[model samples]
Target: MDIEFLKTSILEFVQNHKSYAPFVLGLMTFAESLAFVSLLLPTMTILIAVGFVLAAADIPFWQAWAGAVCGAFLGNWLSYEIGQRYKKTAYELWPLSRNPKLIARGEAFFQRFGPWAVFLGRFFGPIRAVIALIAGIFLMPQVLFQAANLASASVWAFIILAPGAGLAHYVLW
Candidate 1:
């Protein structure tokens, strides 16, 4: 039940069941992109670990990337919908609840860059999910929001997941 033990167990479980790798990757990416969940999930850490497993296990690099990309896209899109539907009310929610300053910063960031904020925000650790929500709250046009979201998610996914996977593959095999 200890955190380290739990993490080790999860990693062992996933490594044993190679077929589940994509699902694990997707879940990690989803948690990474989800609003309040991002604060809790150590996604960046787990993703590197997953990348190593993918390489060690011979999972195709592209497959893991695809899972990560889809999960991130879906997660951010859901956050955007929440922002659009709840507007400022989302600020009162659990994760964002305590981080009023973050929302404000995201708002200012969006104001400065407009829709491009959605794309650029994808690279910032704390800002990604928050920017998506702020875009919704600000009523950024849906088409533009999604365009940037999709494009950013692809590059972000590649940048985060590929290095470890590629390095492991090259070094090990």
Candidate 2:
């Protein structure tokens, strides 16, 4: 029910099923990167915790990284597709409609960074959810969008997971 409990449960799941860490990380990153869904999940926190679990369990980081990369890429790609298909209607969507300021900020961020916004936005919590959608609304080129999405997703997953992994490795040793 609570975020802490949910986080603990997810971490416990990873610990108990160590072989599934990459799959779990993939799902979490997918949910975290997806537009509307990101608002609802504490996946970022879970991801950090999973990173720690991976190191403590001696799981290879690359496996988790690869799974995360694929999930994040697909999530953003789907959000972008939705914005492309729905266009202005995306603005009227529940969470986006409810938060005008968030939409405005995502628009401004997209305008400011252009295609790079997809890459840059992933690091920023508020805009990370919507930037890909904004990119779709504005009709950013497909190739460029994918380029940034893949690049950012790879690095973003690493940034989210690596610190905990490194710290855990240090402490465990």
Q: Which candidate has the top score in TM-score?
A: 2
lDDT (0-100) at residue 44 of candidate 2? 82
Candidate 2 lDDT trough over 10 residues, lowest sum: 6-15
For residues 1-173, write the lDDT of model 1, one tens digit per residue.
59778756755776688777777778888889877788777588778767776777777888888889888888899989999999998898887888888888888999999999999998887887698888899999999999998999889888887778878767656
lDDT of 2 by residue, 56-147 (tens): 77788999898899889998999999989999799898888999999999999999889889999999987988998888988999999999
Winning candidate number (lDDT): 2
Task: Quote each prediction's TM-score.
Answer: 0.87, 0.90
| Model 2 regions lying over 4 Å from their true place | 1-16
How does model 1 score by TM-score? Answer: 0.87
Pairs that collide, model 1: none
